[model samples]
Target: MDHWSSLSMGKNVLMERRERADAARNRQAILRAAEELLRRHPPEQVSVERVASAAGVGKGTVFHRFGSRTGLMLELMTERARELEQAVTEGPPPLGPGAGPAERLVAFFAAVAALAARNGNLMAAHEHAMVTRKSAAEQPREANPIYLFWHRHVSELIAERRPDVDAGQIAHMLLGTLHMEPVASQLRAGQYEGLAASFAAIVRGLMGEE
Candidate 1:
């Protein structure tokens, strides 16, 4: 199983509990196998057959568990999301429900950027996965949970300050700047320290404040 590829909550929920449980167990086994392989072997050398054999299953189980190598990667992304959600939901103060919306918004993006930098391949993988699906049938995964989390905070913050402006659009605009890689790269290149200030100013401007 690819760590990030096959984690489809919606797809699994439809399964009978037994099937779901079995799938989950198999999924875990596959992930463990992949993790072990990653520690010892290069990714390209770790084939689906190798993964299945490591997990004590047939080669087809690899295909069933994750549609393909790409599916495996997507599962990994989902794992990352689950881990991040668990961290913020269970671990500490700044990330939990008690933080103010504006503060939370800042904390969220900085954390995401740091996570992206650490994972290094995550953003590129995500863009690839998303672009692939955009060409296929149906909506892309409601993949917004991570993105929406911050957008919601921005919306709430705007609502507090503006009362009348469309918090939705304002939230999109502010978070758009924060999460946009081009803007982030510019900020990282020492092009400006003003990005944060500019973000704040835009949010404030949306609220009709100077």
Candidate 2:
């Protein structure tokens, strides 16, 4: 319309773009700071204030972006798992496509176990923070995005191989065993060895393979 109006609209659009870019940069900086803190100190020691200072942002910014430490941890978990999720969605077989359901299931569980083993501390911290949040306000574990993705994938694979049984319930049962605390404990105790084979045998049994 008018020249002045067009100039104002362009400025607003530019401002919005800059805000989004700044938010993205702040998010990555916070996550990286939190990760380094977790590596150096225990989860309980890593606070939002500490992360804010490390990321060179104000504490209010961290709280505004991630409601609480639990939220921050969950976002970090999602970030770390993003690559694995992408691989499952679009990468090669058996982790991706082009493989039987049983094989894919096995690969998926093994990959999850490996991820957990590598990030045992982060997993444990996330679990601890989640528990603390749950005590104050009930938050359903099923609502977690990462868990939902894994559950959906497992359910589909199970349903493909065993149409009679309740794939959803079976997927839940299997995922329960792979939860953060138990998997972290197994990793800590050095008992995580041979986990892949164990997972494969269990998957084959569920698939009714010989």
Candidate 3:
């Protein structure tokens, strides 16, 4: 190709790369801002304009990146869910690959409880929004990918230790105890006193002296 044409093509490629990098940076900023805002305030107060202002991006940029408020919240939920899943599947011991099933199960519940403690409001808001949308009404709480992953993980752990027991039912029961309302209630009542100890006790009972 001609020298001018080659230079123009190179410039275009560089511009595209820069644009992609900027978009990624903006996305991260928006997520961070949204997370911080949601942590400090309720979901109704966390508007796109507020998030955009906190993120230092134009309001239109937030919509352009996430399509809508519901879309943004779903993206955040997906990100947090995937991060927790990775920690349980691939990260350090107890929660990850290196520990025995019993130990891993204990760690798994603790991690899930912590996750719910941190993001329970955000998760509930996201679920409510999804349920409100006509197209998403059929997707129940059980259909949540994070919940599915947790259920399967707990069932596998139960199966490993108690082959004769009904692992799936027990798994659901264990997960129910870790639900946001229960955990929040426990926190309110005990001020998080012996939280780990309580989880250990439950784990022992569930795993049956293992």
lDDT of each: 0.60, 0.87, 0.79
lDDT per residue as tens, model 2, 1-210: 999999999999999999999999999999999999988887788888899999999999998998888889989989989999999999999999999999899999989888877777787778778777744664566888999999999999999989999999999998888664656688544455577678888999999985
| Candidate 3 lowest-lDDT run of ten | 185-194
The collision pairs in model 3 are none
How far is 7's C-alpha from truth in model 1 (Å)?
A: 35
Candidate 3, lDDT over the whole model: 0.79
Best by TM-score: 2
Per-residue lDDT value at 30 in model 1: 87
lDDT for predicted candidate 1 compared with the true structure: 0.60
Q: Which ten residues in a row have the lowest lDDT in candidate 1?
A: 134-143
Candidate 3 shows a clash count of 0
